[model samples]
Target: MRIFALETDINKIKQKFCHSGESILLSTPYHTFSFFFSSIRELFITIALFVVGIIAFIYDLPMGWTLGVLLFIWVVFVFFNLLKAYVDWLYDFIIVTDHQVILVDQTSIYKHEIRPIHVDNIGAITTSTQFWNIFPFGILKIHLKEGLGGDTVMLKYVPHAEEVAATITRAVSSHQSRSQTSAQRRELSGIDDSE
Candidate 1:
């Protein structure tokens, strides 16, 4: 049993999808505030559970079925919410690997969507933020192959989104340069072959 659930989950994903020599450059989840604010209802429920536990302890409730039930309720509430948050934080990520950019969305345990866009296919990158348009956190938007009508990938409430966007942009540029060189060489060879 892995002591840290998040690391364990991430390891599983990496093991399953990462290709040979495709090292992970970066893996980022949404900002912490995003996790808490995304589900306000869950926050309230967690708080209420704490209150109930406190009340039971203060009242010196009988150590019988009632106490067990109370503890059980607390455990379940904490477990479910933690699980949900963990899943959200785990699957909802902006991952940059050597070969491509990966966007993962796991809305539920059984349902997940993984989109991998080659670095050469990325067309644009943008960032939206606060604190003079550059602060605590921001949104990272990645546009893929604009001429091909590729859709955008959004990583909301990402801390240091500006930096992440820059990294992706650099990778895209590097990939494009290599691709263009390869194309030019092929064209030159084709002309020679025709002769």
Candidate 2:
């Protein structure tokens, strides 16, 4: 999506919002912070069942009881999917802006928050993953300077993470250069007033 304009002093930004180019990108770190457990929920359940199954086998439970345990596990798997969906809907974030990066987040249906990441303060764009995620669904982490305060907003599970990171990196660099030049000009003019 193309950046159209950004007004940092007013805390406003605008970006292209065509459905085709629109993307929901979350910081891998943020995504993992919120729903990282969802990825391993099934694994933990499976392991617990394996341990229980071994104990049940030792006790020689009736075939009916064994079937019941297996059914319970199946139900748990279905419930896990529901939980994952809810997490996805709850904390999803989209970075939308034509000139600067604005983090648009929905904390809840009734509450929403948007934070702008100064393009100049965006330090680096990168991605990282945990040991387990590498094999199946790899995670992407974008690192940035804490200019506007707080941690970097990660883009998690992004399919084309490298490409997105590159775009952000370039944009941030350009923003910084422009900011440096502006600062120099303002200092030379000795104008500290904001209007």
User: What are the RMSD figures for all models against the true structure?
Assistant: 4.4, 9.7
Runs of candidate 2 exceeding 4 Å displacement: 1-91, 96-98, 105-113, 129-138, 146-150, 180-195
Task: Give all candidates' CA lDDT scores.
Answer: 0.74, 0.53
Model 2 lDDT tens row, 52-153: 777788899885788687768756784556455444544554453323555555433344456666555666666655455553333445456665464656
Error of 2 at 85 (Å): 2.8
TM-score: model 1 vs. ground truth? 0.69
Q: How accurate locally is residue 164 in candidate 2, as Cα lDDT from 0 to 100?
A: 58
lDDT of 1 by residue, 34-145 (tens): 6666567666776886687678778887657556776687568666776677677655777888678877666556566777778877889999874465447888888777
Candidate closest to the true structure, highest TM-score: 1
**What is the clash count for each candidate, in the order shown?**
0, 12
TM-score of each: 0.69, 0.44
> 86, model 2: CA deviation in Å?
4.8
